[model samples]
Target: MRSDLQQILATTDFHSSFDNAVPLMTHLSAVRPNTLIADCGDFFEGTGYYRLGRGVLERDMLLALYDVVAPGNHGWPHYLESELHRITVCANAYGRDGRRLFRPVDVRSIAGRTVAVTGIIGVQAFNAVPYGQRVGQRVTDPALALRELKRAYGQVDAWVVLSHSGFEEDLRLAEACPFLDIVFAGHCHSDAYGPVRIGGVQVLKGYEQGAGFAQARPSESGWEAGAARFADASSLSLPNTLEAVRARITAIARDLREPIDKVRAPYRHTVLDRRLLLEDIATTVYSETSSAVLLNETALRAVQLHGTLTRGDVLAVEPFGNQLVSVNCPERTATSLVSDLSALAGPMVVVPSPLPSPLNAFITTDYLAGALHLPAVPTGRSLAQSVQQALTGGTR
Candidate 1:
């Protein structure tokens, strides 16, 4: 550990769960003087706040807090916005004309020691983004980019990577880029919270959805890193400075909680049983459009709905704002489409227990249609609407 540096704090994959904003911000504000605050991206597009508020809140929060950030596939476009673009650092992303998309490294004097903070988006994660959203954008191999950056910024005391790649991919990255001191990982939502050392590099991530952060402080060996939850900060009150932001968030959340419908029984969705919720929505879409439906579990979140349902509940269930689109599938390609989708998205919900061989057409999200390279006819409806219908047993 360097004598000049104090501590580093970072959040990853915060998918617009602003319910934690006050406490999180209160904590961040308290620690801002000595702590280097950063985020590993996917900050936008998750709950009703992002869906209905349209990223204003997310952008505002970033402007108010983050010092540096990495871009994630979920909020790929948001990183391009001028305010965020200025703070974003990425080593690999490039435009079609071969121009670097963002500053490869952000060098700052953390205390007195020169520290270089660089970011990289995994190739697989970048490709997972909707094609249209990433038009004219391309990425090189993350390790390749890091190697180039290391040579370019050779004078830094410490090299830290804010990676939008999953935790496992980062372990491999750490092995490849042994020059790195610490790797803060994001994008793959799994139970693995590791400061798992790989070839002398430390790799870990914060608990996602604004619940926690990853922290690093100077240790005798090098840097000791671990995950920290925001539970202690839950009781913290917002300062007068952030009260306005808190009010706006409250107003928007209240609107999102406005009742839209009712449910007779509780319908629960959890990580273990995401398929049940997807199956229910698939049935609704199938019944409405009279077409086979394909829905991946990742498109929707796991939530429990009961009694009076609100827009927030619906959006929480299917947070990405996906729209249903119809795509034609010939008999010859139908089987292969199912197989390929199964491979790409594990254990997806396919309407019709056994897909009919002569399936003429099927319904899927616009994102999936683009991913599959299939021409789609827009149904002029959103998956969130279908979720509402499914729960209420009626049309919106």
Candidate 2:
């Protein structure tokens, strides 16, 4: 009976877990012997390590550990490269050179059974593309990607889709293909406790930063899947390479005392009142693109700060890897957006007032824009770029 059960472990939305990266891999490796480990994407660009290291330092560590990987919306282009994604299985992503970045499907032998894994991202990206990374690259329609993967690896004993696409997309995929047995959902950032059944498929989701990975073990009739029970890995020790990266990060922190500008009254960001900050950010975007700025209030997830401003301070306030995008929408929709946002507190948003009947709008993040169903054009100007330009060498 024990021999009949096989374990497949997975993690999604790591966002560059600097702490205990390799040691966590060690822990995972030792925890489940002969288990096939897979990582769903959005695995980079959160902490200072990404900013300083360009994700290479942590990328190498992840390469050594994960058996197969998928590129999330934020971890695109870089993670799509050959070195990191050689064992990857992403159906939708392509390079600017018009080449498929990774193998569409991976088949692994686990517990005398064949386990197949593949990945798909949201139709719209959560993170904007960094400059000079890849020009004119496209993530092909995910629905088509799944059909392609299905035709290729349809006969596998157990199949899993690491879906960075939202929950609804996963449900659609599950309905389209009855062969799919399990789905690990991402992009929504939910810590789903149990499985949501759609046809024969069981979908599970883990929270941000590997709150805990998903664990799926074989059952008598099918697989049993859910979030793993464990402590957050933030306190654990990192591997030697990452420890060295930490050392560099610490050193960099020492020299970060240079003041960029001064702040008036500490320009605090509070949920109770976000008007001042939004208007400030919107004004900047308005100047750059000549578009009314609309931003998801979640962009300012930092605590109150008012004092001498540093480069670090600005980056901390706009911590997400979002870029400014220009969108053309009916001015009335702007009113509708603010109205809808006013009604809901969870997904708060801000749009500059008195929009022209037909006007151009500047947006901050794709995740929010997509959720709001706004049409946008990519500007390639990142949040860091906007902050540096807005608050650098200038008092506010």
What digit string (tens of lDDT, one per residue) describes model 2 on residues 29-113?
4554556677778787665456656777657756655777777766676775678868677888777788776778877666676
Give the Cα-based TM-score of candidate 2 against the true structure: 0.72
lDDT of each: 0.84, 0.64
Off by over 4 Å in 2: 1-6, 17-26, 94-99, 126-136, 139-144, 191-193, 229-276, 283-313, 320-352, 357-396
Per-prediction TM-score, please? 0.93, 0.72
Candidate 2: deviation at residue 175, Å? 2.5
- Per-residue CA lDDT of candidate 1, range 1-396, in tens? 223447788999999998777668888888877788889989988888998888988888888777899999988998988999999999999998999999888886664557799999998889888988888889999999999988988988888899999999999999999999899999999898889999879999999998899987756677878998876665677667577778889999898889876663446322324677678888877886789988887787776666777788888888887899999867445678877776665567898878787778999889888877788999998888877777677776
Angstrom error of the Cα, residue 160, model 2: value is 1.2
Error of 2 at 382 (Å): 7.4
RMSD of each: 2.6, 6.1
In model 1, which regions exceed 4 Å deviation? 1-5, 232-241, 266-273
Question: Which residue pairs clash within candidate 2?
Answer: 20-238, 266-306
